[model samples]
Each structure stands twice: as C-alpha cells, then as structure tokens.
Target chain A: MTFTTFMQHLVNSISLGSLYALIAVGYTMVYGILRLINFAHGEVFMFGSYMAFFAMTTFGMPWYIAFIIAIILTCIFGMLIEKAAYKPLRDAPRISIMISAIAASFLISNLGIVFFGGIPVTFPRPDIFDIRIVIGGVSIISVSLFIPVITAVALVILLYIVNHTKTGTAMRAVSKDYEAARLMGIDVNRIITFTFAIGSSLAAVGGIMWALRFPALIPFMGIMPGLKCFIAAVIGGIGNIKGAVLGGLILGFGEIMIVAFLPELSGYRDAFAFIFLIVILLFKPAGLLGKNIAEKV
Target chain B: MKRNNKLNIIAILAFIATLFILNVTLDPYRLRIFNLAGIYVILGLGLNLVNGFTGLFSLGHAGFMAIGAYTGALLTMSPETKEMTFFLEPITPILANIQLPFPIALVAAGLVAGAIGFLIGAPVLRLKDDYLAIATLGFSEIIRIVLTNMQTITNGALGLKGIPGNANIWWIWGVSLAVVVFMVLLIKSSYGKVFKAIREDEIAAEAMGVNIFKHKMMSFVIGCALAGVGGALLGSLIGAINPLLFRFLFTFNVLLIVVLGGMGSITGTVLSAVVVTVMIEYLRVLDIEMNLGFIRIPGVPGLRMVVFSLILLIVILFYQRGIMGSNEITWEKLFDFKNRIAKKITRRKSS
Candidate 1:
C-alpha cells in the first residue's frame, strides 16, 4: 500500500481499463443504433487477436503491420456480420436478431476451437513492448502506458466521426427512428455497416491489447470479458459512447482494485462487476448516462 | 380447464408408468442420466417461463442453482463428513447438523434457491431483454466467484465432496415432474395470460394493468428454483460437487436445451431434453478408438464437446425455431393437426 506500489497498480488498472473501454465503445455504438446487443463483438475481438497472432508469427510481419492487418480484417468482418446475420432479420423481433448474434458468436468461437485448438496460447510480445519505463519512482510496463494512449486516441477519433460526419448523423437518425430515418433518404443500411466496422475495429484494438496484457488466447476467453464489457456499456448507459468508456474504466479499475486491495477476496473480483450490474439495473435502470428509452406499450 | 384436466390425468398415468418401468428394468447409470434429463427438463421449462413466456432474457440460472446445490449439499451431508471435507470449522453448523432426508434436502434446495432468486430478481428483473441478460449473467458469475472464494462456506476451489449420494432416479424424476405440473398449471391460469401479454408487449401489458415487475420476478424465481433443483440433482448424482462442473458451458448446454426444445414450448423442451441428452451420450461413444483396417485412429479428446458445439451452431443457424417454435401442445391443435395429417395421407393413398 505504499505510494510506489499504489502507483504501479494504478497504471496496471488504467491500462486494463482502457482496453475494456475500447471494446465497450463498440458495444455502446452498435446498441445505440441497432438496439441489438452485438453479442458477436467479443468474437470479433477474438478474431482481431488471432489475426494479429497469425500476422506476427506465421507471416513474420512487424508488430505494427500485424496490428494494422488485424484491425482492417476485423472491421470488414464486423460489417459482414451485420450484412449476414442481421439484415435478414431486420423486420423480425429484436429478440431474434439478438439470438442470431449469439449464434454468430458461437459459430466464430467454435470455429476458433477447430482452427486454433482449445488450449490457451501465448501472445507474442514485441521487443519494444517488453521494456518498462520508470516515471515518478514507479516502473510501468511499456504496454501499460501504451494502452491508455491507444484508448484515448480511439475515443477521440470515434467522437469526431460521430459528431462531425454525415454518417454519424445518419446513424443517430436511424437509432432514433428507423422509419423516419428511411423516409429522410438516409442510407440506413450503409450507416449500420459503418457502425459495425468502426465498432469492430475498436474491439480489435482492445482485443490486441488484452492479449498483450493477459498474454494468452483461448476459445472461451471472450466469455467473461465480453459479458463484462456489456456490463460496462450498461453501467455507462447503453447506447452512449462516452458513457461506455467511463463505465469500462470504472469496471476494469474496480475489478483490479478489488482483487489488489482485498487480496483475501481476490477470487471474488470477477463477481464484483456482475454484482454492480445487478445493483445498477435495480436502482438506475437506465444506467449512469442512459436516458429514458420510453418503450412503446 | 378441460385441457388441464386431460393433461393432468395423462401426466399422472405417465408418471406412474415411468416409475413402474424404471423400478422394474433400469440400471443405476441409465436411471441416473434419465433423472438428470428430467431435472434439466424442469430447468429448461422454468427458464422458458421467464426467457420464453415473459420475454425476459436472463442468464443467471446457474447462480440460482449454486445456491440450491449448496443448500441441498449442506442438508444431506452428515455432520462428521461435512466437518472433514470442508473447512476446519463448519460455516453453517446448523447445515452440518442438518441430516435431512434426501427428499427434504431436494425440496429445501428448491425453496432456498427460489428465495435467492426472489432476492436477485427484485433488482435485476427491471432490465428487460439484453441488458437483463448481461446483468443476470454477471449475477451468475458473481455467485460462482463468491461461492468459489468463500472457503469459509463452500470450501473454495477444492469443492464440496462426499455429500450424501442418496438422490436416486425416483427423487429427481418426482421433483421434476412436480415442477412441470406446477408450471403448466400456472401457465394455463389467468396469471399466465398476463405473463404472456407482458412478453408480447410490456408497455401494453403495463397499460393493461399487468404488474410487469411482479410477473417477471415470479417467472424468474420459479425458473431459477427449478435450475437449483437441477443443480442439486447434479450434485447428488455425482456424489460430489465442484464449482468447475457448473461452468458457463453448462449454462450454454441448458440454453441449447431451451432453444432447441422451442423457447416457450413445454412439450418441445421435454422432447429436446431427451434428444440432447441422448445425442451427447451418443457422442461420448466417439471417445472410443476405431479401426478401419488401413489406418487405425484413437478418438480425439474433447471430440464430443466439439461435435456438440457444432450441433449447437447448426441449430442456431438453421433451426433457431427449434422443434416447436413458441407453440404448445393443446388438445385442439394436436387433434386437428393429427387429423389433417391423416387426411392428407389417405388422400395421397387414394390418388
């Protein structure tokens, strides 16, 4: 509990928090527009990490190139998910769409099991990533500092696109009222695809960072984090991007701090977010930043 | 009332027959799996009440079950074994002293589980659909993580072992059958209609004076309680229980059962429970080595799980409506559908 140790843990928690925030933004954006949970986002993140792994190991590409390739493919893949699983069910009940998303997620994970095998594999840490930087008498892992920076840049980029762009306006319009947006000559389909692509790309970056930090990959890895990120989205107010980031940091840091400070109850750390989610759902059903989404009775 | 009367009699007769036949001609292992299936059937049906009938997406059934399993495990175990196996000091000494009979333990498990479900449902049931799903999933994980880490009570990761293995085929089947009967009766009542209306349109249901929160909690608790009974049966059948056994995979398996059986369909759930259990067990045969003359190959490990996952994927992709969709087995639909099929066959034969 000294200053140095506390600072070290803070850096660790922040890095972890940033990655969660990155993945969570994707969830919030998609949910904002489509009102679907995008259950496959976790798999998309997994896809990103695996793609990076292949780029670095099989192709022998440089670290940055590997990351770029992974992000590009995941973005395209996310859009495809919308095109394939969702478009057909556009007119169906939202439940069916959610179910379809779950199916797609299961498909991807099982496919991963087939291709990548069931065991956890180590992520390749580049030489630069292995180096730790000392600041203010605390040694921080290079990856630890790198994560928050990546998250901030991604958040800024997303904010700019959503606030200052035509596509963003269209997405907002569609989210508010699909029929109304359609009537206004908004390319509803294109906006959705773009939403999926952007969300997926961000998830890819999160996934990449997650791998570098946790340093392991497995088929079921997404199950816990995916659920937690969804919680982050909910806690921040579903469909609000900034809310999602805030929620993610709160959850990620909350989880790590619980485990770190309450060492005796470290095993219960994972449950902490879930307990918070339940409490939040009970108290502030709309979440921290979520407005009332008046349901049509 | 008419359908209820008819189904009640048929269910009772079937139960008697199953009890008679099971007693007359089945080994413990076969009976065990059948008992497991019955428990799962109950779990699926309970989940169907909330997720299927009420249109609430909840994924915390396992958490409810852990509560029930621990309750039942504590009740059934003797004081000495409880002392020797778990923590140095018994957390619930009353639990250690609770050498309740097997049937009592199972019932207690359901009740205790239902109570926890009530507590959890009060808070999380407000979240409808996907948010509710995440929240509930978190609840389940929290329950598990807490249960795992609470070495003072659940013995942590080492798991609670050597609980009384007294729950035979009859107990599981008896309890499951009772739950199904109870739920079916509930579903046919006026209260059930309100639940369905809420599912169809929550806003409209609320406007129409259906207390949405109450109905959702009712279903959620009942489902969770049944899942608890399932977990208790699982504990009894194995004679020991570990946190690892009830992983997210088990949740997915039960979910597949519900979806495959047809989300809101009781008959579909019963049928699919049989199908999935049999299918999985059949896949277990894949673990055996095979010889094809030219090249002999040993069975790959975890092949059954892979195959099961593949089947689940296929089901989700192509047969998402499952066997029955949201339809139930009412007498009119059954008789009318049967007659229509008969007439079609006769007409074809005549042609």
Candidate 2:
C-alpha cells in the first residue's frame, strides 16, 4: 500500500478502535462486577445515539447541548434497565439473568423500531465537526481526530475513578468478592449501580461518536458493534479495563487491514471479529491480558 | 402399569386421529403454520438436549440450521432451478446435477450438520458458561458470513428460489413425533441420567465417572442433527433457501420456545413450540392495519416483536420455570385423568 493509503487506514482504525474501546469498557465493567454478560449493553449504546438524534431534532437543542443531555439520559436508561430487568433476578440462576439480558436487548431494539420507525435516519452533523484536515495528502475528518482524543480522555478518567475514588475501591472490592465486600460495610448494590451508570455513559459517548462517524441511525445498528465490542472485551481479558482498549485497537486494525489487503474478502469483514473471538477463546480462554483462573472440579 | 399401557395406546391413537383430521380440514395457510410449529418442536427438542439437558449454553443453532437448509436445498433442487438461481455465479459442477429424494436429502443434511456440530463441540465444549455461548455465537456468525461470501455455492445473498415444497403437515408432524419419541426414550435410559447429572453439576458428574466430554459431544451432536432436520423441513416448507432465513432471529425464536417451555421438559417444549408459533402468527395482525368498530389504527411494522420480546422478558424475570417447570407428562398423570373421567360417568349414571 502507498504511504497515503496506509496513513488513511491507520487513521480509520484509530477512530473505529476508539468506538469499540468505549463500548467494551461498559461490557468489561459489568462483567467484572456482576459476573454477568449484560447483553443489553449495546442497546444502551444505541439508545444513546437515538437520544442524541431526538434531542437535536425534537427538542431543537444545539449539538453540544444535545450530546451532553443524551449521555445523561442514556446513563439513566442504563440504570433503569438494570433495575427493571436485572435487579430482581440477581439472586436467581445465572441462566435466568442471561435470558433476561437477551430479552431486554430484543425489547429495546424492537421498541426502538416501534418508536423510531424501521427506516434509517440521517444523523445531524454540526458545522464544528464538518471540518477536515489533510496531512501528507491523507485527508482526515475532524471527528476522527476527536474520537481518539476523547477516548484517551475517557480512559484516563475511568482509570482515575476505578483506582483512586472511594466508589472505585468499593467497585473493586465488590468485583473481587461480593459477599466479602458486603461484610466490609460496602454498599454492593450501590457500587453496581454506579458501575452501570459510568459504563453506560461511556457507551453513550461511543454511540454518539459512532453515529457522528457513520451519520446514520437505525434501531438494530448496535447488535454488530455490541457483539464486536464484547469480543474485544473477551480478547482483552474480559474483565480488564485497559485490556479492553488494547483489544479494541487490535480488532479495529485487524478488521480494517484485512479488508484493505484482501478486497476480495471484503464481504467477510464482519465475520473477522467473530472468527478472531473463537480462535482466541479456543486457544487462550483467559485472553491476552487475562490471568488464568483454575476451574474447580 | 398394564392399565396405563392401555390408556397410553388409546392416547396415541387419538392424537394421530386428531392430527389426521386437522391435516385434512385446515386450509393451506393454517397447514403451513402447523407444519412450521412441528418443525419448531423438532428444533426446540434438539436445542433442549444441549441447553436444557446437558447444561451447555450454545448459541450456534442458527449455524447448524443454515448448514442443514443449504445442504437439503442444494441436494433437492433441480438443475433448472440451480441454473436459474446461480445467475450471479455458476454453481460448482459437482453439486449442479446431483438430486436426491427429499427424505434422503433431509437425512443427509442432518448427518452433515451433526458432523459439523461434533467438530465444533469437540473444541468448544471445553469452555464453560458464557464463554461457550459467545464462541458458539461467533461460529454461527462465521457460518453466516461464509455463506454470504461464497456466492458460487450459496448463490450469495440473492438466495435460492423454487425448491420443491415437500414439507406437508404429515411429514413435519411425523418427523416431530419421531424426534419426540426418540428424546423420550433417550431421557428414560441411563444415558439420559448421565446427561441430567452433567447438567446438574458437570464437575460432580465427572467425579462420578461420567465422561463429560463424550456425553456433552453426544448431546451437542444429537441436538444439532435434529435442528438440521427441522431446517431441512423448513426449507421444503418455504420452497426457498437463503442465508438470511437462518439469521440469529430464528435461533432467538427457538431459544424463546425452549426457555418458555421449561428447559428440560419434552412436553413443555412441544406445547410451547405450538403456542409460540401460533402466537407469533396471531400477533401478525399487530403489524397490519386493524379496523376496529370505528377507528382504524395505523399498523406498526415492528410492534409484534416488541410485544413478544416484552413477554419473554417478563416470563424470564417472573416465571423462570416457565409453564412446565421441568415437569414431564407421565403415564400416571394421563391415567389419573382417565380415572376421573370414568368416575364422572359412573356418578352421572347413579344420579
């Protein structure tokens, strides 16, 4: 590939990876705390994008204001989903919770179709994001630059919250041992709720960034990305936060680079993430960054 | 036990009689729905083997079904239809002229799916819980993507049309009954106990001398084979085969039936299969304009799915055991009902 083309692909991978990283954080955090795969997390991301769309169109808010409001709304919706679908079934069998999560995902997407209609909507692009930068004959959109910067900032903030704050300590304690954390005067449920809120807010940011990049909004758009992000989380050692970002970048580059080199297999682009996931799962169930936990017989 | 045997024979006869009567009386549309429900029963039973009986959370049912559907369709399709459908890219020469009878093709499809399932399960069954679920799900997606990319073989996304419709209600229900009987007998055997033991606690089962890998592979393969049979019948019923037909939503529906029917209960799976299939059809009205007494409400295209999903969510949250709660319909229960009927008749005569 030419230098300019290589540069363009690199830029594209970075932007895509940022989105995956943002979504994967939500998946990893929830899995870390609850030992539950929150299948509805992607729907939370989809809700965020749609919220941004509605805030701009229906409420006539400016883009920046709408973005902030959308993230906040998405956080509330995420928590609401947990409370309604997951909270009651906390003590039940794991299968029930998983089924509930799948059902919630279906419900949210179908409801989105019922409310948003099945047709794809054009995402509103503000003038501020319309700017494009050209470096060494490789043109890059301003949003592409903003995505990675925003993701880096979010990752730093997330690290600070998880490592430094009191709630972060509580979260770590809960994830390590739920009953033990409770015995130590930690409000386990409260920490979980906080985790969901933060995770979902990150999903909103990712969703908004994703929509800004793609410029289209559909009810079921989250499924593929959601699955891909989950794969990314698994690849990065499912419960590790920084591993999620690393895995996202690897997935992003793998997808872009595979298609870039082999145009004949471009149709199989979506399958790459899944195939990678299976291989990683089979050969290394603990993941690249995950520590192996022995299965008790 | 002798009296129960007599009652069981009579019940079987009655059921067959009812099925024959319904087959003759129902219109083509309703017959199609009935056949689809029978197919679903086969699929649900097959899935229940792995998910409900063996306790392995596999989400690759769609992939297996796709393999079966494509295999059955390709084998049964005439050269003319194959030629017509492969206008985008010519089909492979070896597959072009081969045509098998529907039943043989369906069996072959099942065998192929079973073999593939064995291969996939050999490596994947080692993973536990959610990891297995995700890996299986990934395999299914890979199958879909491969199908979409391999235009010469699968006709790409354009899909194959004009396959013979050999899936009548009799054939569908006949296969469903055979599957049910096989499952019932299998569950009654020692192997079934082993499966249940694994489901209850795999490590303990392993400690108890059960070969977890072999038994899990058996469940996965058998389940996949039945899914394949269902898919073959479905292809024949629809008279078309496509990658889109075996999308994750199809697996989702089957999963819903298996869960709602009470996971290891054969009777529950069969009953819920019929109910869920019919309900899905019944809810079609929600997607269309329904003109009530006065106001004609505009139809919402995706509202039925919304309602169905909500129901599934509520059912999982509040009624996790579902309608059957792992209970089977036994001979004793049937005999008790018969005895009650006899008592009512005797009391009427006395009165």
Candidate 3:
C-alpha cells in the first residue's frame, strides 16, 4: 500500500480506538463503583446518538451546538437512570442489582425503539467533516481528526477530575470500600451517580462520533460496541481509567488489522473481542492492569 | 434429613399428580408449549444448580446446546444424504455411511455437548463470578462464530437444515418431565444439598469440608448437558437451525426467565418459562387492528416486544420475586389449611 493509504488506515484505527475507549470508560467506571455491569450503559450510548440526531434535525440547531446539547442531555439521563432504576437496589445483593441493571437496560432499549423507532437513521454529517484533507498524498475524512482530539480532551479532563478533585478522592474511597467510605462521610451514593454521569456522557460522545463515521443509527447499534467496550474495560483492568483507553485502542486496531491482514476471516471479526475476553479471563481474572481488589473470601 | 425426606415424597407425589392431570387434559397446542417449558425447566434447573446453587455465573449455555443440536442433526441424517454431502471430506466411509437411530442420536448429542461443556468449564470455572460471566458470554459468541464459519460440519450460517422433526408433543413433555424428576431427585440427594449449601456460603461450605471445585464443575456439566438436550429438541421443533438464532438476545431471554421465575425456585422457573413463551405468542395476537365503527385502530409491528420489555421492567420493579420466591412448593405447603378442593372432597364423602 502507498504511504498515504497507510496513514489513512492508521488515522482510522486511532479514531476507532478512541470511540471504543470512550465507551469502555463508562462501563469500567460504573463497574468500579457499583461492582455491577451496567448492561444498560450500551442503551445509554444508543440514547446519546438518537438524542444528538433529534437535537440536530428536529431542533434545527447547528452541528456543534447540537452535539454539546446531546452530551449534556445524555449525562442528565445517565444520572436519572441511577436514581430511578439503580438507586433503590443499592443495598440489594450484587446479583440482584445486576438483574436490575439488565432490566433497566431493556426498559431504556424498548422505550428508545418506541420513541425513535428501529429504522436505521442516517446521522447527518456536517459540511466541515465532509471535506477531505489530502495530507501526504492520502485523503482522510475531517471527522477522523476530531475523534482522537475529543477523546484526548475528555481523557485529560477526566484525569483532572479523578486525580485532582476532592470528589474524585471520595469516588476512589467508596469504590475501594463503600461502608468504610460512608462511615468517613464520603456521600457514596452521590459520588457513584456522578461517576455514572461522567462516564455516560463520555460514552455519548463516542456514540455520536461513531454514528458520524459509520453514518448509520439503529436502536440495537450500541449492543455490539457496548459489549466490545466491556470486553475492553475488562481486558484493560476494570477500574483503571487509562487501562480502558489502552484496551479500546488495542481492540480497535486489532480488529481492523485482523480484517485487513486476513481478508477471509472477516466473518470472525465479532469473535475477535470475545476471544480476547476469554483469554484475559483465563490468565488474568483481575484484568491486565487492574489492581488486586480481591476480598478475603 | 428425615423431616426433609417426608416432605420431599409428598411434594413429588403432588407434582406427579399435577403432571398426570395436565397430560390427560391439555390440548396438543398447550401440551407442546408445556413440553417446551419442560425443556426450558431442565435448562433452568441445571443452570440454577450451578448459578443459584454453586454461585458460578455461566452464560455459555447456548454454546453447549449448539454442539448437541449439530451432533444430533448430523447423526440422525440419512446415510445416503451424508454420502452425497460430505463425500469429498476426510470423513471415513464407515462414519459417513452410518445412520444412527433417533434415540442414539439424542444420547450422542447430550454426551458430545457434555464433553464440550467439560472442556469449556475446566479452565474458565476457576474464575470468580464477574470474570466467569464475561468468559462464558464470550464462549457463547465464539461458538456462534465458529459454527457460522464451519461450513463442512455445520453448513455455515445457513444452518443444518432438512433434519427430521422428531420432537413430538409427548416426547418433549416426557423428556422434560423426566429431566425435572432427575434434577429434583438429584438435588434432594445428599450431593444436591451440598450444592445448595455451597450456594448459601461457599467459604462456609468449604470450611465444612465441601469440595467446592468438584461440585461446581459437576453442576456446570449437568446444566450444559441438559441445555444440549433442550437444543436438540429445539432443533427438531424448529425443523431448521441457524447460528444467528442463538444470539445474545436468546441468552438474555433465558436469563430473564430464570430471574423472573425466582432464581432458586424450581416450580417458579418452569412456570416463568411457560408464561414467557405464552406471553410472546399472545403478544403476536395482540398486535392487530380491532375497533368499533367510530374508532379505526391500525396493526402495529414490533409493538409486542416493546410492551413485553415494559412488562418485564415493571415486573422486576414491582414483583421482583416473580411468581414465586425462593421457596419451593412443597406438598405440605400445597395441602396446608382450608381450600375449596379439600372442603368439597370432604363434604362429598360425608354426604
């Protein structure tokens, strides 16, 4: 392949990886706090895409403004989800809570189908993104550049919030031990909701970008990305923020390279993530970068 | 143990009577549904033994079922067809020409599925619940992908078609009943109690000298094997099989059923399975245009799923214990206090 084509693919991989990482962060964060797989997080991501679509076309807003509105709306919805479905089951057994999460996910999903319908709506690409930049004898879509930049900004902001902020410290403490943190006046519930909100907002950003790049939106679109992102989160070490990004980049690049290298195995593209999941679970149950959070059972 | 034994027999008798009455009275349609429910019961009971009883979260059931269904389908196909189909492949002349009977094929399916399950369970079962859930979920997807691509053995994505539909209404009900009986008898045994004890507290059970690993593996194997049987029956019932049919949604469906039925309640699981199946069918009927002269209603597509999902969410929110709690319907419990049937029988006898 030519140098330009190679750079194009590299850019594509980075963009793809960023999207995966963004979604993975949400899954990992929720799992970190609640010790429950928010099965509905995928649906939440789906909600973001639809919300952005409505904001742009239905409200006749500019693309950038619509995008911002979508992100904010999605984050608000994420907090609401925690309040309505998940908050009540705070003290329930972990398994029961997981079930509640799954139910909540299904509820959101069907509601989305009812409201938006299941038809694949083409997300309108902005004129600026439609332009092609020929950098080194290769043309790349404008949207490709934005994904990584947005992802990096989000990542840095998240790092600042998590590392430098007071609330972040409380989140860490509660995640480590809820009862102990609660005893220390951590306001564990609020922290957990904030974590979900932040993570979900990030996921919405990923989803909106994903729709723009792929240019197709379906209600069930989030299922695959959601699953792959979860796999990424697990493979990266569930609670580690940087690990989620690493996992997503690996998966996104790996899937693309696998398909590109072995053209015949395209059918097994979906299997690729699951295989990684199995291998990781087999060797490193705590994930590659995850700290030892084991209890004395 | 003595007290539990008396209670067990009474429950067993009552269950048997109920089965007998249902068998006698149920129409072929209801009987077919009951049979399917029974198959699901085996799956739920087996899974309950592992997840509910052993505290191992396995979601790779569809994988084992796929193995069993394919094996059964390959075995039961006519030898003439096999020769025509797999003639170029390395399949031996004796093997390719061999046509197994229905019963042998069924047994072969379960055994092969069990062996595959054992292989999958061996390494992965060592992981804790959350890790295991991801692994198992991956395992199911991998199985689907493998089956979809393995054109020689599985016919790829088109699925193993043209198989005989050997699952009569009686066969399904009979097999399902047999499985329920087997699980009940096994769980009632000393071994089964140990499984329950492990579920209650794995560390405590371990301290009390229970071999956690062995019991966990055993339950996983048995549950997977039953799923294999159910898959074979499903293959027959559907008369065609495709890899896409066993999606994450299929796994989600069963998970929903098990949870809604009260994860630990045996009767509750069976009842939940039947209710879910019938509910889906009923929803199909509900998606139609029916109205008076002044009102014109239109038939809506996919509304059923939307509503069904709503109902499930509401059920989890309001009736979370489902139709039954963890409590099993004991014979003693069934016969407790005053009821219309008991009073009527006594009055008739006295008169």
Question: Quick one: best TM-score, which candidate?
Answer: 2
Candidate 2 chain A, run of 10 with poorest lDDT:
A288-297
- List iRMS (one decimal) for every candidate: 2.7, 1.0, 2.0
Question: What would the per-residue lDDT of candidate 1 be over residues B63-164, giving only the tens digit for each residue?
Answer: 777887888887888888888897654566545566888778888888888888898787777666777777777778878877887776788787888977
Local distance difference test, per candidate?
A: 0.82, 0.92, 0.81
| DockQ values per model | 0.47, 0.84, 0.58
Residues B15-66 of candidate 2: C-alpha lDDT, one tens digit per residue: 7998999988999889888888999999999999899988888889999999
TM-score of the B chain in model 2? Answer: 0.95
User: How high is the lDDT of residue A50 in model 2?
Assistant: 97
In candidate 3, residue A102 scores what lDDT?
66
Q: Which lDDT value does model 3 have at B264? A: 71
Q: Fraction of true inter-chain Cα contacts (below 8 Å) kept per model?
A: 0.48, 0.89, 0.48
| lDDT accuracy of residue A289 in candidate 1 | 94
- Residue-wise C-alpha lDDT for candidate 3, range A1-297, written one tens digit per residue: 666666777888889999999999999888888888888889889999999999999998999999999999999999998888788777776666666776677777766766787788999999987788888677788889888999999999998999899998888888888899999988888898899889889989998999889988888888889889999999999988889999999999989877877879998999999988888877787788987765787
How do all models score by TM-score?
0.93, 0.98, 0.91
Q: Rate residue B95 of model 1 by lDDT.
A: 57
**Sequence-dependent TM-score of model 3:** 0.91
Predictions ranked by lDDT, top down?
A: 2, 1, 3
- lDDT of each residue in A1-297, candidate 2, tens digit only: 898999999999999998998999999999999988899999999999999999999999999999999999999999999999999998997878888898999999999999999999999888777799899999999999999999999999999999999999999999988999999999888998999999999999999999999988999999999999999999999889988998899999999999899999899999999988888987888889999987655
